[model samples]
Target: MEEKKLNELTNEELLVLKKKSKSTKVINASIIGFCVGIAGYSLFVAGITWPTIFPLLLAVIAYKYLGKNEKAVDAELKSRNLS
Candidate 1:
Protein backbone atom coordinates (compact mmCIF):
# COMPACT_ATOMS: atom_id res chain seq x y z
CA MET A 1 0.00 0.00 0.00
CA GLU A 2 1.14 3.57 -0.65
CA GLU A 3 2.11 5.39 2.51
CA LYS A 4 0.52 8.75 3.07
CA LYS A 5 2.67 11.56 4.34
CA LEU A 6 1.89 12.84 7.82
CA ASN A 7 0.74 16.18 6.42
CA GLU A 8 -1.73 14.41 4.14
CA LEU A 9 -3.49 12.71 7.09
CA THR A 10 -6.72 14.27 8.34
CA ASN A 11 -6.79 15.81 11.85
CA GLU A 12 -8.64 12.78 13.22
CA GLU A 13 -6.13 10.46 11.64
CA LEU A 14 -3.29 12.45 13.13
CA LEU A 15 -4.92 12.24 16.54
CA VAL A 16 -5.22 8.48 16.20
CA LEU A 17 -1.61 8.26 15.14
CA LYS A 18 -0.53 10.33 18.13
CA LYS A 19 -2.56 8.16 20.50
CA LYS A 20 -1.10 4.99 19.01
CA SER A 21 2.42 6.34 19.32
CA LYS A 22 1.88 7.14 22.98
CA SER A 23 0.29 3.74 23.62
CA THR A 24 3.23 1.97 22.00
CA LYS A 25 5.68 3.84 24.18
CA VAL A 26 3.73 2.87 27.29
CA ILE A 27 3.53 -0.77 26.28
CA ASN A 28 7.24 -0.98 25.57
CA ALA A 29 8.09 0.57 28.92
CA SER A 30 5.76 -1.81 30.73
CA ILE A 31 7.34 -4.82 29.09
CA ILE A 32 10.81 -3.61 29.98
CA GLY A 33 9.80 -3.05 33.59
CA PHE A 34 8.27 -6.49 33.85
CA CYS A 35 11.39 -8.09 32.41
CA VAL A 36 13.64 -6.22 34.80
CA GLY A 37 11.49 -7.28 37.73
CA ILE A 38 11.64 -10.88 36.68
CA ALA A 39 15.40 -10.70 36.24
CA GLY A 40 15.83 -9.16 39.66
CA TYR A 41 13.63 -11.78 41.28
CA SER A 42 15.58 -14.54 39.62
CA LEU A 43 18.90 -13.08 40.65
CA PHE A 44 18.12 -12.34 44.30
CA VAL A 45 15.70 -15.12 45.10
CA ALA A 46 16.62 -17.93 42.76
CA GLY A 47 20.37 -17.15 42.63
CA ILE A 48 22.32 -15.61 39.78
CA THR A 49 22.78 -17.63 36.58
CA TRP A 50 23.26 -17.22 32.87
CA PRO A 51 19.51 -17.33 32.23
CA THR A 52 18.98 -14.37 34.50
CA ILE A 53 21.02 -12.22 32.14
CA PHE A 54 18.70 -12.91 29.24
CA PRO A 55 15.74 -10.99 30.68
CA LEU A 56 17.97 -8.05 31.59
CA LEU A 57 19.37 -7.95 28.09
CA LEU A 58 15.91 -8.18 26.61
CA ALA A 59 14.74 -5.26 28.73
CA VAL A 60 17.72 -3.14 27.68
CA ILE A 61 17.13 -3.81 24.01
CA ALA A 62 13.43 -3.09 24.33
CA TYR A 63 14.20 0.20 26.12
CA LYS A 64 16.69 1.21 23.41
CA TYR A 65 14.23 0.52 20.59
CA LEU A 66 11.51 2.37 22.48
CA GLY A 67 13.75 5.41 22.73
CA LYS A 68 14.44 5.35 19.01
CA ASN A 69 10.77 5.13 18.11
CA GLU A 70 9.92 7.86 20.62
CA LYS A 71 12.45 10.18 19.02
CA ALA A 72 11.04 9.53 15.57
CA VAL A 73 7.47 10.23 16.74
CA ASP A 74 8.55 13.37 18.56
CA ALA A 75 10.35 14.64 15.50
CA GLU A 76 7.37 13.97 13.31
CA LEU A 77 5.03 15.75 15.72
CA LYS A 78 7.38 18.70 15.99
CA SER A 79 7.73 18.99 12.24
CA ARG A 80 3.96 18.96 11.87
CA ASN A 81 3.47 21.35 14.82
CA LEU A 82 1.15 18.82 16.33
CA SER A 83 2.56 18.74 19.84
Candidate 2:
Protein backbone atom coordinates (compact mmCIF):
# COMPACT_ATOMS: atom_id res chain seq x y z
CA MET A 1 0.00 0.00 0.00
CA GLU A 2 2.85 2.36 0.74
CA GLU A 3 4.19 1.81 -2.74
CA LYS A 4 1.21 3.14 -4.65
CA LYS A 5 1.37 6.95 -5.00
CA LEU A 6 4.44 8.59 -6.44
CA ASN A 7 5.84 9.72 -3.11
CA GLU A 8 4.98 6.55 -1.30
CA LEU A 9 6.25 4.37 -4.10
CA THR A 10 9.51 2.57 -3.67
CA ASN A 11 12.54 4.16 -5.25
CA GLU A 12 11.89 2.28 -8.46
CA GLU A 13 8.39 3.60 -8.80
CA LEU A 14 9.49 7.08 -7.80
CA LEU A 15 12.07 7.00 -10.59
CA VAL A 16 9.37 6.12 -13.11
CA LEU A 17 7.17 8.93 -11.87
CA LYS A 18 10.09 11.34 -12.11
CA LYS A 19 10.72 10.34 -15.70
CA LYS A 20 7.06 10.83 -16.66
CA SER A 21 6.98 14.12 -14.80
CA LYS A 22 10.01 15.27 -16.73
CA SER A 23 8.22 14.62 -19.99
CA THR A 24 5.20 16.61 -18.88
CA LYS A 25 7.46 19.39 -17.63
CA VAL A 26 9.24 19.56 -20.95
CA ILE A 27 5.97 19.70 -22.88
CA ASN A 28 4.62 22.50 -20.73
CA ALA A 29 7.85 24.44 -21.03
CA SER A 30 7.78 24.05 -24.79
CA ILE A 31 4.23 25.37 -24.96
CA ILE A 32 5.12 28.36 -22.84
CA GLY A 33 8.23 28.94 -24.94
CA PHE A 34 6.13 28.93 -28.10
CA CYS A 35 3.69 31.45 -26.68
CA VAL A 36 6.53 33.67 -25.52
CA GLY A 37 8.19 33.56 -28.91
CA ILE A 38 4.94 34.58 -30.60
CA ALA A 39 4.39 37.39 -28.16
CA GLY A 40 7.94 38.64 -28.60
CA TYR A 41 7.60 38.70 -32.35
CA SER A 42 4.33 40.53 -32.10
CA LEU A 43 5.88 43.12 -29.81
CA PHE A 44 8.78 43.58 -32.18
CA VAL A 45 6.40 44.20 -35.06
CA ALA A 46 4.57 46.80 -32.98
CA GLY A 47 7.89 48.55 -32.18
CA ILE A 48 7.25 48.07 -28.47
CA THR A 49 10.93 47.67 -27.62
CA TRP A 50 11.05 49.44 -24.29
CA PRO A 51 8.79 47.21 -22.16
CA THR A 52 8.83 44.07 -24.24
CA ILE A 53 11.54 42.60 -22.07
CA PHE A 54 9.15 42.62 -19.11
CA PRO A 55 6.69 40.29 -20.73
CA LEU A 56 9.46 38.14 -22.08
CA LEU A 57 10.89 37.79 -18.61
CA LEU A 58 7.43 37.03 -17.27
CA ALA A 59 7.02 34.29 -19.83
CA VAL A 60 10.31 32.76 -18.80
CA ILE A 61 9.27 32.78 -15.17
CA ALA A 62 5.94 31.24 -16.04
CA TYR A 63 7.74 28.60 -18.06
CA LYS A 64 9.99 27.71 -15.16
CA TYR A 65 7.13 27.49 -12.68
CA LEU A 66 4.92 25.57 -15.06
CA GLY A 67 7.65 23.01 -15.61
CA LYS A 68 7.50 21.80 -12.00
CA ASN A 69 5.18 18.84 -12.45
CA GLU A 70 7.33 16.64 -10.25
CA LYS A 71 6.71 18.90 -7.29
CA ALA A 72 2.97 18.64 -7.81
CA VAL A 73 3.18 14.89 -8.02
CA ASP A 74 5.16 14.79 -4.80
CA ALA A 75 2.57 16.89 -3.03
CA GLU A 76 -0.31 14.85 -4.30
CA LEU A 77 1.38 11.62 -3.27
CA LYS A 78 2.02 13.00 0.17
CA SER A 79 -1.54 14.15 0.57
CA ARG A 80 -2.89 10.82 -0.52
CA ASN A 81 -0.73 9.05 2.02
CA LEU A 82 -1.72 11.42 4.82
CA SER A 83 -5.36 10.59 4.24
Global lDDT of each model?
0.75, 0.64
Q: Residue 71: error of model 1 in Å?
A: 2.3
Q: Which candidate is the best by lDDT?
A: 1
1-83 per-residue lDDT for model 2 (tens digits):
12244445665565567667767877777777776776778687876674656667777887777655667666655665631
| Overall local distance difference test of candidate 2 | 0.64
Off by over 4 Å in 1: 1-12
Instruction: Give one digit per residue, the lDDT tens place, for model 1 in 1-83.
Output: 11346556666666677787778877898999999999998999778887689999999889887677456555666777887
lDDT of 1: 0.75
**Model 1, total clashes:** 0
What residue runs in model 2 are displaced by over 4 Å at the alpha carbon?
A: 1-7, 49-58, 71-83
